[model samples]
Target: MKHLLFLYLGVVSSFASDTRPLKERVNEFCQKHRSIAEIEKRHAEWIKQEPDNPDAYILPANALAKAAETVNIVAGDQKDAIAVLTDPKTGKQVGSIAEGPDPAIIKRAEDILKAATKKFPQRLDIHVGRMAMSQRIKDTEAVTTAALDLLATAAKDPQTLRWIDNEQIDGVPLKKALEEVEARIRWLYSFEKDETDKFAQDCALKALELAPGNVELLNFAAIRHLYRGEWKEGREYLLRAEIAAPRDWIVQHNIARASAELGDKADALKRLQAVIKAVPGTDDAKAAEASIKSLGLDVPK
Candidate 1:
């Protein structure tokens, strides 16, 4: 999944001068993939090659945002990012955008975004990143405002409405792309507070409805159940997800979590231990350790 994400992000650089695809790909990667390093390297080279271009910031920052996941910390270069897109004097970033649970990254991203927005006030990605960052910092009003703004914009551009005639709707075109964007954004907020609401469930459901038997939707639905503390249901969903996404660490992590919550601590611990052994310094491993500690389970360190 991570590799495919990096690949998709390669296609979204808006090397074409548009924020829509780049914004969508970055958000999708953050929520679903485990690493963005490949794309980050690509973006770094892109920036190095085009030092004076404002457009470079969008993909480069997004690349960093994705790479942040791999390091178990927000390991992105926001200053390099904003310096490209930001107007400096006003302190808002435009075009470039990202999401984070890490404060340092969020602050850096927001500062840059503030600079960029001055130059491109109507760019939705800047507002989305700001709102997501504000929520992480616990600025309630800002979160609410961002959500309201996003919802307002989203209302006008429903997945149903973003389609255009003669735009090649089949084999990955406008309609499918728009739906994926909306679904990812909806669940990102739903899962951010470590809880899954009905709205998030709806998004997952819609995804499944769109592509029945899709392992991706199955995995997302499983996580939603996990977030809501529905252990048994979460486990059942995850069992299917694990089958569908055998190599995905995120799914593996959720399986461990649900197993622990359901009192299958031995299985959970084993899975956690195996993942950490396989991928050192991963958030999946950290989360597994946290779960083990919380459950009074012991594992060899």
Candidate 2:
């Protein structure tokens, strides 16, 4: 009876120790069949087997997100027209409303990630994974919220943050991690929506609060002001950036541009000339020369 008990324990342990890559295991269900129902079934089985493994949650979330995107396309849901086509003579308009991702499917993906993060709050990878899904769906607010949450968590105890493999992210400096979040928020700004712009500002300000004198954040602030025609404010931010990274040619050039916009021609000209002189024969100098030409200021030659 003792030998039989040992044999049974060995068999159970062997099944529990899955040596295959986590992604490989999750992706197997997503392959060949690519059906959400089938994937969910397999996911349920995997979850039951490894309820404590974060991969069991995170990888399945990825698969579900992909499946949602696929279903949107396969169902012809993306073909709906955002604008109506009018028949002028008939005075009739016909069109389908713009269709986005299926909310229910996306919700499932988010819920799975939410459960994973709640269970493993220290897993930076899970947090970032959820943020990435939000980004894919163009949910700027959700992404912003997630980014802020990450910043707050990291600020509390950065040393405790861990990645997918359960190893501390100690190798990644806190500044670099903040910059990573900043980069994602910056990507949101490219959408050019007022909402995204506000979210970007919020994220940038929070990041700057944690990492003062960050030239990139300062530059982003300056550019945001420039976009709004706030020349003086833009120049102020750029000036701060210049103090932090005096050698950055882009900042020097932008400072000149902002001065020109603010009607400070002499100062702008002086700054432009300085940039051209400092980086002569480089692409940046070429850009400065072009700016001088556009401003009708004489090139230093």
Candidate 3:
């Protein structure tokens, strides 16, 4: 009877082990650790055990990102404290602390992501992870390069582009990744003081290449050109956006603005009226009304 009980227990143990998923086990292990070093060690073990698993790479990247966030929080507090201090003698600014994430942590995360990229060249998420970590560290070149890599990868796979456009693929949401890349391009457009608009324009164009006919990206590209006073280029993008989203009043409004800037008052007035007609009682309509007034045209009744 004792021998029979032992055999039953062994069978139950084997059955339970077989039913547990590897990803669940890894997640459970990671959740129990607070230390980045411990998480990294466990993730390394996972990679060793399952070299082909993308999660093995993703888990360590996440752990490193958490570490970087912790460092940034501490640094931000230091910077905030510095901002309130002033010189006692002159009541003027003395010195301010410039703080950011630890360089060592950033470097480690970059190295891991680089390895993951080489190992899983087609994994868009890994490139996204790299882009995010680079943004955290304010590495503009790295962020742009990663964004470009993501665009290139998406271009190679129609399904990937579709996933990004539709916001998810295989249960992973692409919205955040797309937003991050777009935000980086917008930032470059607004704050890249030393560089010409070409770099930001190029990044935006590359993104459009991957997600052609994307209205938001098209609008973004249009705005970048308008901001740089390239009215002709801006008008071209606006026309494309109008084609992509014919009933979108905001696109019509932008088309009006671009036309007005290019000294085409009649075209501008016509588009503003169309915008007001298509989306009455909305903010776009209000803006269209204002533009019509600014263009010395009568508001449509």
Candidate 4:
């Protein structure tokens, strides 16, 4: 999934105008399943040859990161890891062995992209690539710093920022990319890590500074405060999100939640009813009905 996000963002695959040959060679190597070390070497040479092309750095970095993933079978109950395999025939839990990306290789990959950022600080794609790779390794500390740097860069003059394919990356396009990062962070937050949760909220708030009216960011911001029992703050963002996406069912659900939290039973009941009306048979509607019952409000006929 992280790899897919990197591809979607054009981070793992983009070529400078004069570096198409390098890109093709890299693609060919990958298709042939050539050694990742060879691919890394080729990309490293390309990086040296074309020091200013951020894509040169990104390609090798991605290869290294992908090559780092490994799976091994060992003994012991390690339920605290990703990709825990089970013994299907026995229908019992087997010993959990840690199998995932190699930390040392991931660090090397991260370092390459980090250097790219230093050389091309204005390249938004490079920064995004780094962030995606860090998330792949579950390096939330790195992610937090990189995310803040990305937001700071985004808050600068648009003319200074560069994206791959020479596409303009301000306003909606930028917002969409940031939202992708936010989605990944949200996934990390689901583990209930205090640092990851704080980083998620910080990311939403920073992104809102760049596009305060973004419905997704607004919703995220509202959820951050709402989860912390800050009803008023959450409601402030939810109301703005509602204005931006008036028909958004999730937004309506959140508004209902905030209203209920604020002790506005009547308002909450009305919004909950609206949610059910807008999205009948969906999870939101079911949840809305449950909320209605919780609030001791009758279903509207």
Q: Which candidate wins on TM-score?
A: 4
Output the TM-score of candidate 3. 0.68
Per-residue C-alpha lDDT of model 3 across residues 22-112, encoded as one tens digit per residue: 3443345446654777767866797788776655555555555545543222222354342534569998665555445565776676767
TM-score of each: 0.42, 0.75, 0.68, 0.75
Q: Residue 119's C-alpha lDDT in candidate 4?
A: 70
lDDT (Cα) of model 4: 0.71
User: Model 3, stretches more than 4 Å misplaced?
Assistant: 1-56, 69-100, 160-180, 183-200, 295-301
Write candidate 1's Cα lDDT for 38-128 as tens digits: 5445546755776433344444444444444322312334432322345478856443434334555445545444443343333444445
Full-model lDDT for every candidate: 0.52, 0.69, 0.62, 0.71
Q: How many steric clashes does model 2 contain?
A: 0
Q: Candidate 4 — which residues are off by over 4 angstroms?
A: 1-18, 21-23, 27-50, 77-98, 159-172, 277-283, 298-301
Could you say which candidate leads in lDDT?
A: 4
lDDT, candidate 4, 1-301, per-residue tens: 3232245223322346554543453454456434567757777687778766656676677667667777666665653465455789986767666667777777777778778776766677777777877877788888777877877766775356656644566666566557656776676567676666777878888888888888887887777677778889989998999898898878887888788877888898988888888888999899989888877776558
Sorted by lDDT (best first), the order is 4, 2, 3, 1
Report the Cα lDDT for residue 167, model 3. Answer: 26
